[model samples]
Target: MEIRDAVPSDWPQIWPFLRDIVRAGETYTWARDETEESARAIWMAEALPNRTLVAVDGDTVLGTAKMGPNHRGPAAHIANASFMVAPQHSGKGVGRALGEYVLDQARADGFRAMQFNAVVETNTQAVKLWQSLGFEIVATLPEGFNHATKGYVGLHIMFRPL
Candidate 1:
């Protein structure tokens, strides 16, 4: 798989997978009822400057990620990121490639560390991937995410020093 910067024209293909993932309400913290326009705006905004990427295999997008300053001004040196892989492409290493790419990009951009703000504890696959990449569970917010099937699940605050 190849990793590359995402352009606005890529949104049409990305929307479906993004929508499915959000609607699943299992990993990401986005509102499940988020409209297409809002999602488009968020994704596009991230693509500007320091915030987004897509993993592609030939012409097909296998996954996508967004990275940015974890906070503004005083906290700007720390980076934060999110990742999503098309369900059809899970287990194919798309997530891992995207994760590694974003981390590299963040470090190259001069970030001092990386943090993931709301990783759902039940999303073990993602938790494992991040942990294997050197992140640690810095904290867990009790009943942080309301899982569709599991009721309330803890949300993990993961961190790794760059």
Candidate 2:
């Protein structure tokens, strides 16, 4: 699969899965009915230090990732990122590949470290993947996430020095 910077033309291909995932309310913190314009404003943001990337196999878009400063100003040295993989492409190593790419890009872009703000406690696959990639769960906020199925769940703050 080829990993590359996402261009405007790619959003049409990205929207379907992006809409589905956000609507599901299982993994992300976005509003369930988040609008297309808002998604573009965040996902395809045209601002400094923000970037979006796609993982593709030929003409198909398997997944995407967005990365940038975890916060503004002096706190900007710490990087943050989020990922989404098409449900149909979940087990194809798409997430692992994307995670590795984001970490490298964060370091290349001069981030001192990478931090994940809120990783749902029940998302074991993601928690495991991040751990395997050298991140540690630095803290867990009890009942921080209001999960759709499991009710309240912990939200893990993961981190790793670049």
Candidate 3:
């Protein structure tokens, strides 16, 4: 699979996967009822300067990632990112490839480290993937995420120095 910069046109292909993931209310912190227009705005913002990407194989989009300053003003040196893979492509290394690409982009952009502000504890696949990529769970917010199925689950703050 190859990783590339995402253009505005790519959103048409990305929206379905993004909508499915967010609607599931299982992993991402985005509003479950988010509209396609709003999601498009957010993803496009990520495509600017220090932001997003898409993992593709020729014409097919396998996954996507967005990277940016982890915080504002004084804390901007650190980076942050999010990822999503097409449900059909899960377990095929799309997430891993996207994670690695985002990290490399962050480092190249001069970030000191990368932080995931809210990783749902029950999402074992993501937790494992981040840990495998060298991120450590710095803290876990008690009963942070109200998962649709798991009820309230902890949200982990993961970090890795670049």
Per-model lDDT? 0.90, 0.93, 0.90
Q: For candidate 3, write residues 1-162 as lDDT tens digits.
A: 999888888898899999999999999888999999899888766534466688998989999988889788989989989898999999999999999888888889988999999999999999999999999999999999999898999999999999
Per-candidate RMSD vs. true structure? 1.1, 0.9, 1.1
Candidate 1 residue-wise lDDT, 1-162, digit = tens = 889888887787789999999999888789999899999878754533467788998889888988888898999999999888889999999999999998888889999999999999999999999999999999999999999889999999999999
Question: Cα lDDT for residue 128, model 1?
Answer: 97
Q: What lDDT does model 2 reach?
A: 0.93
Worst 10 residues of 3 by lDDT: 43-52
> What is candidate 3's local distance difference test score?
0.90
List clashing residue pairs in candidate 3.
Answer: 46-52
lDDT of 2 by residue, 1-162 (tens): 999899999999899999998988778889989999899888985765889999999989999999999999989999999999999999999999999999999999999999999899899999999999999999999999888888999999999999
TM-scores vs. true structure, each candidate: 0.96, 0.97, 0.96
